[model samples]
Target: MATTAQPVAAREAVFVARALCKTYRMGEVDVAALRDVNLMLHEREFVVLLGPSGSGKSTLLNILGGLDVATSGALHYRDHDLVAADDAALTLYRRQHVGFVFQFYNLLPSLTAYENVALIAEIAHDPMPPAEALARVGLEARSGHFPSQMSGGEQQRVAIARAIAKRPDVLLCDEPTGALDAATGVRVLDVLETVNRELGTTTLVITHNADIARMAHRSLHMADGRIARELVNSERVPALALSW
Candidate 1:
């Protein structure tokens, strides 16, 4: 339960994927979700993965989050080999190192925003106070409200708060703003940007919206289960500067 911030060294990669593959078996046929993918995410970097539907973005995110195991090849997070990790080790890694946010706001309907965030913090080995985490997402005033009482954007902010409350080393977001309208999505993205900048957490956001690439430190384009291109922004724009 060490809360001290560790300086991210320059030597080793945080994530290392080499010829990773994942296939799903549906009855008599096999559906290949990911094919020979190799990628790395460094510490404190904001990376956006852009891809159309059925392009294996979610599959890659799942594999990185330890929610699903790769079928072949090597997947390593720091010194730990993720592809060979057992269930217990995976659970430990997720609990200690990773945070996840999804498209839908999965907050419990009965719990207030503060309580919902506190639930996760209570279980985390080293967590920030729920109030401080909620404030980071611009939800300090709405802390007592339930998900039903909040707008879509506000609910999403609460979800972000919950994800970051653990002060995780890595944050994995899959279509975090998919359910919100343009204006609201921008606001949600603002909070995400703030989290990335202030906390120095290594963030990977997967979205189909091409405009989002403007805000990332590096943008990754995925096609047919492989990375098609990678671009580093010379001067990354803030989320508020993004146009549809």
Candidate 2:
């Protein structure tokens, strides 16, 4: 199977990984989560990772987001050497350049949607206004609503708004729609698609659903800690038109 593929038009490579490996020590046993993973993510590209549970999808995303470190090989985001970066450097890297969204919406129950996004914007070096962020996700009207007041999909959009509020260079999402139903999931995917298209934020999404890959510019399939195949879509299907 082909392990590497490029986008149609040449773009600046945002992430370059060569022989990247990640291992976790569990008691006396070492378990490899990623093995010799070589990949290049281009600027403003939307890539989907399809794999089963424990297929190193989240591990690779974490490494890219600076939440975890690789055991071996070189990983670079632009000119930043992620493998050689220290804890402080990694922290700065994440703060300045990366935005992350997990399966769960980590919004505070006590805060409204606007407040939740404003919290992140307040600390960022440069950020869009909280209102603007919520508007991007189509939640400007719901800004005053709390998590309990919104549906699952609405909450997820708010989470996305918070991530993008910082205007980070990259957005890393691990199963962003995993918790929602099919219809609601489509709505969340639409927001991600819109963000990637409009903001030109380089996006990587980890999803178990194969249907989600159809909306991406490129799809990567992983198995047993290695990327097994790569597929490039010449034409992208809109997220709303995708059959869930």
Candidate 3:
């Protein structure tokens, strides 16, 4: 019964999408991945998108993160027009403002944790020290360890550290816990929660897990190709207390 109401003043909007659409071309036909979707993401808000497979959750997240473009619609990240941005502009936007975490921990096998994270920091305009980023994820001791030497959850934490070292304005995660066991997933989720709360990074997560929604400030349920419902959590459930 909680509405999208808060006692505090309204936060500034970071992303605004109006009448968004994305269509995929098959060998012989066109498939609509998204249909006239509308949404707004506020600064420092933790938002979750939930849906079954093929419901367009990933498509929407990809579009927002600049991994893909919408077929048509008004999509803006602050003052930048996402829908109108060229490949170079979109790439720049992602590098300068967005951090991405995927289901798989895409850590380079040859690199140590610190080195993997330093790869991003080296190119970032203003980045946190790789050691500091590792410490933020509770992996300071594992900084010299390679991916193969770490557990799945640890590797994922390293991935998260690499993403955030750039101090991005927004963090987008796609099924970040999908490949891990329940306990490991919880640990990863806690790291994400800590990052969002401590750094005030505007965060968005895509997941099929309903329990994860309880941790979000707001949840968007998707069906077919659009948002079916939106809920504002009256109270957030801590990541440690969430069950599958």
Mind giving the per-residue lDDT tens digits that candidate 3 earns over 87-204? Answer: 9999999999999999999999999999999999999999999999999999999999999999999999999999999999999999999999999999999999899889989999
Candidate 2, superposed: residue stretches over 4 Å from native: 1-9
lDDT of 1 at 126: 90
Per-model CA lDDT versus the true structure = 0.90, 0.94, 0.93
Q: Count the backbone clashes (under 3 Å) in each candidate.
A: 0, 0, 0
Q: Write the per-residue lDDT of candidate 1 for residues 108-175, one digit (tens) a residue.
A: 99999999999999989999999999999988999999999999999999999999999998999999
Every model's Cα RMSD, please? Answer: 4.8, 3.4, 2.3
Top candidate on lDDT is 2
Question: Could you arrange the candidates by lDDT from highest to lowest?
Answer: 2, 3, 1
Backbone collision tally, model 1: 0
lDDT winner between 2 and 3, please give it.
2
- Provide TM-scores for the models: 0.94, 0.96, 0.96
At residue 165, give the lDDT of candidate 2: 95
